[model samples]
Target: IYHVNNWYGVGVGSVVFYNDAIDANTDRSLYRKDHVYTTADKIRAGVALNNEFKFGLITAMVDWGVYLYNPARHYYDNPEHPIYGLGRRPLFYKNDGAGSDEAFHYIRFGMKTRIWDNLYFSASAKTHLHICEYVEFGLGYQIPFLKKENRKHGEKIFHHRKNWWQE
Candidate 1:
C-alpha cells in the first residue's frame, strides 16, 4: 500500500489513492469476461481513510476504501438483441466508464505488534462491502541499524543525555 501522508499518529487522517485489478486466475477458476453479462476486471479508482490506534507498543489500524468504478451492474437495454441467442435474453452494458457503486466499498482493519523490539507480527482482514473476502497474517523483522543507524546514533544520544543530567 502507498501512503500519501508522511505523518503516522493517532486521530490523524491520511488520504490515499489505490488502483486495484483482479487478474485472470485459471487455478482459482476466476476469469475475465467481455460479454453482455460479465464481471468487472478493475475497480478503476479507490479512495480510502486510514486511521491509527495505539496501545502501548502495539499499533492497530482501520481503513475504509470506496471503489469508484465498478462495471459489474448493468441494465437491460434490448431484450431481443440478436447476440442474446435463442432465449432472446436482455443485453446488458457497462454501467459507466467510471462511476461509483455502493457494493464496491471495501474495508481493512488490522494490528501490528513488536515481537522482539525489531521483529514484529501483523494480522489483518479484508472484506468486500459487508462480505468477508480474506484474512492475512505476516511476520516481519526490522534491523535497528537500517533505520537511520539507530543502533550507533541512538546509543550516543542516550549517553549524552545521561551525562548531561549528571552534570
Candidate 2:
C-alpha cells in the first residue's frame, strides 16, 4: 500500500506611481510611470504505488499528481492611471489581496534493480502534462553496508532497517 500528499501557493504585488502634477489643462502624456500588482494560487494532490518483486531484488513505483486553479477566486484586474489625472481624480484603491490562479499536473514512474551482490541501480522519469509546466529525469546507484572480506580487525557489524519517517 502507498499514499502521498502536497500543497503550495504563489503570489506577487507592485505599487503604482504618477510623475506629472494634475491641472485643469494638464497634458495626459505628463505621466512618466504607473505601477500594478499581481498574484496567483495553486493547489495539488498526489498518489503513489510501490511493489517489491523477484524476492526483493527488484522494485517498481508510479505516482500521479493533479493541480487546480480557481480563476474567479484569483485574478489580477488593475488599470493604469495617467500622470495628469493626479489630484484632479479621486485615487481609488482596494485590498483585493492577490489576483490570478494557475494550475499544473504531473506524473512520475520509476524502477530499481539489485544485480549481483553489493550493486544496486535505480531510475525515474517525471513530467508535467499541462500548459506552462516542466519535466525532469534522474538516475542513481549506491552500495550500502558493504564490508571488506577476510578482515583481521574487530568483527564488523551491519544493521539494516526501513525508514518509515520518509513515507
What C-alpha lDDT values do all the predictions have? 0.47, 0.32
lDDT of 2 by residue, 1-167 (tens): 21111111112222121222222233433222342212322222333323322224455645554323222111222244342123232222232222121223335556655543345566665543332223333344444343445322232211122331222
Where's the lowest-lDDT run of ten residues in candidate 2?
2-11
* Clashing residue pairs for model 2: 16-35, 74-100, 75-99, 75-100
| TM-score: model 1 vs. ground truth | 0.43
For residues 55-147, write the lDDT of model 1, one tens digit per residue.
655668788766554442222223344554323322222221222222445678899876664577889887655545567798987544333
Reference-based TM-score of each model: 0.43, 0.26
Best by lDDT: 1
Candidate 2: segments with Cα more than 4 A from true spot: 1-56, 66-103, 115-119, 130-167
